[model samples]
Target chain A: MRPIPPWPRLRRGLEHDYTILTVREDIVADPRTGQEHPRVRIDCGDWVNVIAVTREDQLVLIRQYRFGISAVTLEVPGGIVDPGEDPALAAARELEEETGYVAGRVVALGSVHPNPALQGNRCHSYLALDCVKAHEGHPDAGEDIRVELHPREAIPRLILEGSITHSLVVVAFYLEHLRATAPR
Target chain B: MRPIPPWPRLRRGLEHDYTILTVREDIVADPRTGQEHPRVRIDCGDWVNVIAVTREDQLVLIRQYRFGISAVTLEVPGGIVDPGEDPALAAARELEEETGYVAGRVVALGSVHPNPALQGNRCHSYLALDCVKAHEGHPDAGEDIRVELHPREAIPRLILEGSITHSLVVVAFYLEHLRATAPR
Candidate 1:
């Protein structure tokens, strides 16, 4: 397929800084008709999520209250990847911090753009095998999390039944499924 | 499992309106300690995407330039659900408008929160069985899209090969897979 030409930036507009994300506006001209339009862009740090499984094949999951949704959600351990930090190490750190699960081995599964239409960040997924509890979890000041362990086979059912509804979490499991089923 | 209590809103801070999304800040008190903290929230309309398959079993896909990533991306046809519009109907409308494909029948696959930590919206997925070209697509003024068809079996490879990197698209395909493999 031929590459789609990108729009030319006309000027930069206002920018608003939130703690986790920054919103900015850019004026750009369409390549086809040269029509100018203002597009909103969200700048965020790359994120990392781990599909950590125990030696007994139990999946480590977390239930936390998300402020945006105003409710608790079931998701994998994840957080923003620190600046200049390796995504694999970030994945391992997040896993251990959120659930106290230390990984025996960590490997990258894949990555995806959370929302390329408005966000410029990637969320990297990792598989942490043979995980075991190392210490008490240390959630952030605003975070309250409960860790749960389930059979790895129940992931598909959890997702299908809507118990797990975070898009990034679902993508992580999907990537893990692809890796497990791939031809060696 | 016990339910996690929600934080109480202390006050509303500021709100900024963007064309596609609205950003606002809310001051809320933690349930455990009553400590107040500011949280950023992004308000967006619900969204819908269609996994359209032709009678010949070819998957309908589209390539379009996303301003957020500043590049072209391979994705399925989708758009924000209009106010009071049924998500299934919106899915069909988006499919027709973005790719000019009309579905013989449409069924709901499932839904997921795009980001419950920051965005309060759901992205609903649908399966459009037996889709066919109806007319030339009519994308929005800022949209320029190219439609392509691929065998349904190639989706996993496309995703794994990083040709399709949108989180919502990956979630949609994962939901379809769960539906296809569910025991009756």
Candidate 2:
């Protein structure tokens, strides 16, 4: 397979900052041709998602309204990873804050770039086993979330029926499935 | 579960057009509180991804350099759906354009918003069965892609090993898995 050579960045500058994400424009020289073009990149901070499995073998999920699509989506616990913060810590913090669930063990599932075509960030997925409700959830003012628990086996069916349509949440479940089936 | 009310859009305007995606800012009023805030939304065109399964039970895949992440990614054949074009047609066109393969039957898997929290578009996944090489591939100027075929059953392992990390492509496969396993 012929690998495409990396483009040489001629110049880059920040275009906009929207708190959650920042946009940047870059002038890069195409390797095949010396010509240059301007490309825009969205810098969404690296994020984390946790599949919190309770001692009863249920998965903790959240249903919240997302403004962009204006739909209340059923999803797993997730949030942005703060700068200089470990992704696992962010996963644990988000899970607790969104569902008031704490896991005894947080194992790494895997990571994926949410949208490598335009977004510059990775989403790390973790499996939080033996989770239990530690306290009442404390969601931020902008976030109005309701938590739900489902048997682990029902996840694939939920995904198929579109009860959970978030792509990253689906990825987290896919990783969990792999981890469960993989020989130790 | 308590469903959060959708925020009211007080005002909206296009902030930036980056050719591939347009960034828009919207002033939204909180449903509970009467406060408004400016939030950014990315308007990317609807996209299509095809899971092309050949007569030999092989999956047609592509490896290409993605500028946003600066990495060559293994992914399913996909591209933006042209304005006024059907997503199924776009899936067929992209499969042939990227891998020179044609399918006897192209079935709709389902659609999911790539990132509904910030992006306003849906990605439709398709199952192209009995695929065969129709002609030589025709990649666009900016696209440097190489095609590869893998045994259909090897897909889950590919995804588990981080070889296929594109979230949407993984979603396509997940949909295909559901389509295969669902009671028809």
lDDT per residue (tens digit) for residues A17-111 in model 1: 98788998899898999999889999999999899999999999999888889889999999999999999999999999999989999999999
Instruction: Report residue A149 deviation for candidate 1 (angstroms).
Output: 0.7
Instruction: Kindly report which residue pairs in candidate 1 clash with one another.
Output: none
Residue B12 of model 2 has an lDDT of 88
Candidate with best TM-score: 1
The C-alpha stretches of model 1 lying farther than 4 A from their native spots are: none
Interface RMSD list for the candidates:
0.7, 1.3
lDDT of 2 at A19: 74
- Range of the 10 consecutive residues with the lowest summed lDDT in candidate 1 chain B: B1-10
What would the DockQ be for model 2?
A: 0.71
Q: Which lDDT tens digits does candidate 1 get at residues B94-174?
A: 999999999999999999999999899999999999999999898999899999999988998999999999999999999
TM-score of each: 0.98, 0.95
Q: DockQ of each candidate's interface versus the true one?
A: 0.87, 0.71
The TM-score obtained for chain B by all candidates, in the order given, is 0.97, 0.95
What interface-residue Cα RMSD does candidate 2 give after superposition? 1.3
| Candidate 2 TM-score, C-alpha based | 0.95
Model 1 per-residue lDDT at A166: 99
